[model samples]
Target: MNKIISAHPVGAGLKIFQNDPEIKIHDDVLYIPRIPGPHDSNYGIYDSYGRLVQTAGPRRGWPNFSLGQSQSSSISPSSSYPRATENSYFYGGHIGTHFGHFLTETLPRFWCAPHWYLNKKIICHSGDTIEKLFSVSWIKEIFEMIGLVKEQFIIFDRPTTVISLLIPGASFEENHFSHRQFAEFCNKLGRKYAIDLGISDPIFLSREKFKSAMRTIEGEEEITSILRNKGFRIVYPETLSIREQMGLFCSDRLTSGFVGSAFHNSIFCSSPRGLALCYGNSYSTNFWLMDQVNDANIQYFSTPTLLLKNSPRVGVPAEFTVDNPMDVANLVIDYYEEKSVLKKENEKINYGKKEGPYLIKTKFNSFLQIDRQLGKIHAGSGVGPRIHKIFAYVFDSQWIELFTLGGDVLSMDQLDSVSDTLNFKMQISQNEKTFSLKHPVTSRFVSTTPDGVVECNREYARAWEQFLLISANQN
Candidate 1:
């Protein structure tokens, strides 16, 4: 890892746009189309001055890591590209796919859409057709909530030159805190369109449905069970419509959940209120900005655990188990409940487990064999249909315990070392057949090096870093 001697978070020092509707108008602009592939071309609008309009696209990793700043991928349009005689206002590009990003990044500039640019056509590089662009029901509802009709959108796929383009500066920085203007816009819009559901019970936003192979929290069910017994209602945000979510989150009730886009729904709350967040591994600085803008009484209960696999991004954690779900649930229970009404169910909560004597192999089809004498793991035996060594695994809460068929434990320390217990997290690949083991205590993956040496020291799980688990039959 390349260490920075003097590292600083870029967010605290960012220069945000003023809290007002500021539109930058450019005449005779060229719009470039992106050709999707291994190396997709950057798509954006370029002005007559030969400068890519910064407001036309989203900038990721801003004010965070040094490499976070996204450069303008806007290239010159070819002469053969079609020209649009009409003018349109810029909306956003590829960032619209995600709900959080759509709310924070794509629609932030649209704070001026209702009054200033209500009649102007909005142009974006999101999809080919308006139906495809607004394919998501809630997203379409949100656009309609802001008075933007389907006819008002101009979805451009191929290269097209425009006579005029109006670019509204984002009221908030991409990865930093949002401005008061943007916050107030969401507040007013949410309240205006919010249906009166009269939701009273405290809600726990569950990420169960949205859980992906890359970022799964293993012990979330146990935590949810404990919270449920304490009177916290478990809610899956994906199951609710945009209006229902707005109404639910806006109600005068305590909201708790793992830090994610669901928590971002708090932006629609009538005002800032109490939020109990279950956090593990790393967190985004954007939460701080959210709290700052919303004035939320945010309480973070850290459920620390090392990520099992590596995330695609630098700061994102791949997979982790909540160290102590009961501790976090207790904190939320104490903070929310005035009196404990249910105790019988809490005692019956059982954590899930997976135990197997399985064979572990590398992507190159090499079996992983442990050398107990040296306390080292290595890739051994070439591909063939024959008998070989096998391993067994047990789940300890969300932690995975790797053991030899002979009952030797896999430890970061030597086999017989009396150090802290080594905890491993198993991450299943997208294909589901392959898996990668991560050493949470040391934040390393059980990876095979270039020379075919197995070590729990890989930072990322690339092609050679992946492992496949095969179920072995016991005699």
Candidate 2:
């Protein structure tokens, strides 16, 4: 897998490791061909296994701007420091600019995206009293849920695991990570947190007295009054706690807000009938909010603000009133009317709640995950292989389906199956605490082959046949 990209090393004398690296290494130390800066996050040191080789002292994006404190030293990039101890793991990530950062950039990097190497511990910038950065709570909940709360997380200001992981940021490389996969993780967490904290009244996201008040709507009071008079309870989302905030928004069916961080909370809301957004010309992009809101079956309507060119300030909707107020009000009214009709129909169908027969929830082995499995259903045409685990879902017809983990379900075959063996009965052993999966058509139990092939050719269930039905869903 190694090809010498360049015949000469940039430095005096160094040996090329593999691929066509930016530089060469020599001795016990790797004399970097290019000297990096203090805040250069692009530095990467890798092993043969493709894992990032960690270095001591400050990582790139530290002093978490939110935390206002970093353990990184004041040493210059030219000075020599102790290399990261062999096998020493760490927690690392980015200090993103906005709410969209948490949804699209931050959490995905931490939990769902590929890093220099896999890290169990995480570092966060916490704030219990502060009004900004709702990230710490989300980080904590994730660590706790993943069974990593014991020693897997570290916060800049708070006490947790104080290690640093050598992971690259999105800027260092392309984020081939799946957005849909990240959304599923959020959905799972939203459901669990929502269940813990009871749901609340329909929320009207108000930025009237919020910190980022510049981007607020023109005549916001009138707009808010229109919503309040209808049914929305004007809510300042930043004032409340994370769990409480999630519960309030997740439970509501209809919502409206001037496009900003407050409205980004719609990430927790699942399958809503309609969501209204008002934005200024300067605030052209909804950021990752568009992905979350539109994905939830929420009917979206925008009141576009247009004004004179070269306006220095952004999100000032009041300065220009290009769109008619009556038109905006009509759209809002029409949306609510549709929302009302949809809610009743949903009630009749019991639409939102997922009903299933199989109970697939538990703690899986650390290095191995049987909680979810994906392999060649068949190596023949139309069958496939995947990077992530395959998911199982129960349809309205009460049949089990093998769904794609990170790819399109339809593009890959959504294999529907009904195990006819023993009428879908599993040989669950209480003494051993193991269960075996049986293939109905073959009548043999599912077994792992030496070649990593999932086969049902075994006559009797053995160690490979036994499986753990661990119940952790990324939604």
**Where does candidate 2 stray beyond 4 Å?**
1-79, 112-178, 195-202, 269-273, 280-294, 304-310, 313-327, 339-475
- Which residue ranges in model 1 land beyond 4 Å of their true spot? 1-11, 14-18, 37-41, 61-80, 87-95, 127-129, 276-278, 304-317, 337-475
What is the RMSD, in Å, between candidate 1 and the native fold over all Cα?
16.3
TM-score, model 2 to reference: 0.44
lDDT assessment of candidate 1: 0.60
User: What global local distance difference test value does model 2 have?
Assistant: 0.39
Q: Per-residue lDDT for 1-475 in model 1, tens only?
A: 1111111122223333336756777777777654443244456677665566666666644323311212443555455568875754555444355777677677777776566668677777653456765777887888888887778777677667787777777766555446767777778877788764565778888876774533677777888998888777888888887887776567668877777776677777646555445344334545556666766655544443423444455446466666666765665676576432322112111336766656676776777665555434567774443322546454643344445555454433211112222346667677876667665433346677656576564556767768765766632
Instruction: Summarize candidate 2's per-residue lDDT along 280-375 as a digit string, tens digits.
Output: 211222332234323654443335332323353544433434344544544555566653232211101222334332333222221121221323
RMSD of each: 16.3, 20.3
TM-scores of all candidate predictions against the true structure? 0.62, 0.44
Which candidate's TM-score is highest?
A: 1
Our tally of clashes for model 1 stands at: 0
